[model samples]
Target: MIIDVLKNIARFLILSLLQVLVISHVPLGSHFVLLPYVLFILMLPFETPKIIVLFASFVLGLTMDAFYDTGGMHAAACVLMGFSRTHILKLISPREGYDNVMKPTVQYMGKTWFSTYALILIFIHHFVFFYLEVFGFSEFFSTLLRALGSTLATFVFIYIVQFLFYRNDKISI
Candidate 1:
């Protein structure tokens, strides 16, 4: 129990630093913002309480907002994503229904399932974030395009992080 908590804490710090110091500077054009920080929220344990998730997400977003000078946009989007996480999990739940898994990872859930789950949540996060940043409908098409592009870019980075940093520990006997 304590180990899991420590692991999550470490993950949060690592991802936060990566977002603020590294990914934020890797310019991918105007429309594509890389929010790999969302991966920290998405990779949280399945059994984590809803309130805890929201709090953690809010803190994470606020940290980003402090760095990016986006005011509360990241916080709002992250909170919404955290709020919607439970429903999304229920929506995409497998027949077995998460009885064995603690965390949702590509290794545990398989590529197809993890990809679908990550893509949907990331899209929600990016869509809300971009819309809030733009703050109006005058540039609706551009905002939508930016959200979609950022979602794709962020998804790619998250996937790479999962593959490279997180290893499959389950052994086949």
Candidate 2:
């Protein structure tokens, strides 16, 4: 139990640092990339409780907001993503079954499942975030264009990173 706690804490800190770095360094057009943070959320163990997940999401977003001076936009979008995570999991659940040991990854879930899952969550995060930041639909088309472009850029960046960095081991789902 203690080891698990320590590992999770370490994971949180590392992910937080990565998020900050990605947000500060990477540019998707006019906005800093936020998709790596979504990957952080997705990388959490399947058994993590919704409340804890939501809280972590909020903290992650708040941290980014602090860096960007965006008040609570990132926090709101992250909280929303956390709120919808369980539903998304249900939607993309494995065909055979899922063990408690399961982790979200392309190998564990398959590329199709992983891509679909990431795309949906990324779109949700970017749409809410960009829209809220702009605070208007008066420029509906432009806002959507920005949102879509950023989402694609973020998704591609994260996907390539994951592919290069992580190795997959087959486990029973």
Candidate 3:
């Protein structure tokens, strides 16, 4: 239990730092890089309450908003993603169902399911986030382009990062 708590805290800090790094445009075009905040949400113990997930997402978003000065756009997007998380899990749940030890990863959930799940959530997150940031419909094509491009960039970055650093043992939920 202590180890699990420590792990959770460490994950929060790492993700928060990643959020700042991505938003700060560290790699120039990296602002388009998908911050791996969603990974944190995905890593929570599978039995975590829905309300807690949403609340955590909102707080994470609000923290980002405070840093980025984008009002609550990030917060809103995070909450929406949190709200949709369970449904996505249900949709992709395996025939055997998610054992208590399962985690979201290429190895556990399989590449196709994991990719689809990540892609769908990432798209949803970027769409709501970029659009809300713009707060206007006039730049429809531009916003769509930004959303699609950014999603692709972020997705690739996240997948590569996870593949490199994600531990096989840690993957067991």
- Cα lDDT computed for each candidate against the true fold: 0.89, 0.78, 0.78
**Candidate 1: regions farther than 4 A off:** 171-173
- Give lDDT for model 3: 0.78
Comparing 1 and 3 by TM-score, which wins?
A: 1
Prediction 2 TM-score vs. true: 0.87
User: Could you give candidate 3's per-residue lDDT for residues 1-173 as a string of tens digits?
Assistant: 56766887788778888778754555636236556666777666666778988998888889888878999999999899888988998887888787767767666666798789888888888889988988988889888888888888767867877677765555444
lDDT of 1 by residue, 1-173 (tens): 67888999999999899888988889789888899999989988998888999999999999889989999999999999999998999999989788644468887787898999999999999999998998988899999999999999999988988888668654342
Candidate 3: misplaced stretches above 4 Å? Answer: 27-33, 170-173
Per-candidate total of colliding backbone pairs = 0, 1, 1
**Which wins on lDDT, candidate 1 or candidate 3?**
1
Candidate 3, residue 50: CA error in Å? 1.2
Q: Tell me which of candidates 1 and 2 scores higher on TM-score.
A: 1
What's the TM-score of every candidate structure?
0.95, 0.87, 0.88
Candidate maximizing TM-score: 1
